[model samples]
Target: RLRAGVVMLIDLLSSVPSVVFGLWGILVVAPAITGVYTNISSALSGVPVLRTVFSGAPISGRSFFTAGLILAIMITPIITSITRETFATVPRAQKDAAYALGATNWEMIRGSVLPFSRSGIVAGVLLGFGRAIGETIAVALVIGSSPQITQRLFSSGDALSAVIANQFGESTGTYQAALIGMGVLLFVITLVISAFARAMIARAERRIGAESV
Candidate 1:
């Protein structure tokens, strides 16, 4: 419930310009962290700090966390809207039935209601995942734009969408083909995940129907 409400708020917030968020991340949040990191180093050193504060601020252009976070910002609104719609679709009669059976709100949501709407929720989530995977400009602006992969949230890395966004214009024939190939790979992955989610949803629906009958 907490997460849903937060996602709802973020979704509402995200309807604003993504560039605004990107720029805000760049100008404000980045500086604060850079200052903190630099200050920690300066404090540890006994000698007076020669390097200017944040003069060599980390580029912070790309990292897995940065890309994921930017994409999350872009997709929050979409996911929240989809979730709201899915929840709305739950039949009033079914909810009332659960209530009559002495089910609490959480119980009703956990049992009768969720099972019926599970497929739609899964569908919505898969769509949101796809949207996150495809976001470009917002991610490009903040992602350190690095090609190498690293596990650290602070390290820079690029996603397929970010790479395409960064290099497509300058790309020549073979480079463009390579970019297209990356797109194809992403498309394939998305398609597979969607198909799997749909299949699982279908199986769950069938199981629920059987159990109910």
Candidate 2:
């Protein structure tokens, strides 16, 4: 019952519109994390390498870190679901074989399931990555939509999707062209990543088939 409820919750979250998530992040989660963000900013202020990364105008909860956190949350269910389904598809015989070899439960999983499911895991992760890269409204809202190149996780920075979404309306000829170019780049990158993931999944399926035969 608990597992079913959790799965149902995940399904609902996955189905929510990106704009709604953005609003929730901006209104609720971002403010809630402000104190934590401030502490992190202060701690990183003195470090050498990290100081540079964390250096920015001011620490804000609605920053790169927050955007990343939101994206992670949004993608979690997708990756988790895919990985769970992939593991579920693993043959009982392989697990039995591992146990017959005196493997413990964890060892059996490590020796059999994981090896067979690695490609699916990679594919799921890549799918999540692609989703994150293309995310526009949610990322734009939480990332503060600033056009800066700071490495500070707590600093406002721009992503291609965010920039295009926020500026396309008011942008002029050159700026609009640039934004289009960015969009094209994002599309090409996503395409390549998806193709790679598909290839990995296919390879895994072929391997499984051969082993089964």
Candidate 3:
């Protein structure tokens, strides 16, 4: 019953409009976290490698860091729901066998349940990452829309999707073609990542098969 309830709730949350998430991130989440981002950037200023990545104005939290954080939050429910279903599908006998061998609850989960669900979890995470990549409204609102490359994570920045969504209406000729090209690039990248994920899943399945043998 609890599991069913969780599934329903997650479904409802995932169905909410993207623009709503954008409004919330910009109006509520961004204002709340601006100071935190600033302080973190300042605190990391002296660190070697991290200093370069973390040093920035933060500019009231409309930044790469904020956009990424918001997107992660938005897609989390989808990933969690998929992962929960994957975990729930594990065989009862496998868990019992682990316990019968005197395994702790955590150990049983690690040795039995996770191995079975590993591929499913990876697929779920990939789905979430893909969703994040295509997200536009929320990202556009919180990403500050700056078009530049920088090591500073807190710097204002925009993603390919955000750029396309924000500019496609006014773009013309070469500008429009460039935006379309970005979409193509994103699609190719996603395909490559998916293929790599498939390979990883296949390798893991083979390893598990060998262990069982």
Give per-candidate clash totals.
Answer: 6, 0, 0
Which window of ten consecutive residues has the lowest lDDT sum in model 1?
48-57
In the range 26-81, model 2's lDDT, one tens digit per residue, is 99988888887767667888888987766563445688888999999999888888
Question: Which candidate should be chosen as best, given lDDT against the real structure?
Answer: 2
**What would the C-alpha RMSD of candidate 1 be, to one decimal place?**
7.1
Task: Identify the leading candidate in terms of TM-score.
Answer: 2
| Candidates in order: C-alpha RMSD to true structure | 7.1, 1.7, 3.3
**What TM-score, computed on C-alpha atoms, does each candidate reach?**
0.68, 0.93, 0.86
Relative to the unseen true structure, what is the C-alpha lDDT of residue 84 in candidate 3, on a scale of 0 to 100?
Answer: 84
lDDT (Cα, 0-100) at 96 in candidate 2: 97
Instruction: Report the Cα lDDT for residue 55, model 3.
Output: 74
* Tens-place lDDT digits, model 1, residues 54-130: 12335553345455666676766766665666677666878899999999999999987777777767776787787
- lDDT for model 3: 0.83
Q: lDDT per prediction?
A: 0.68, 0.87, 0.83
60-99 in candidate 3: lDDT tens per residue?
A: 7788888988898888886898678678767788899999
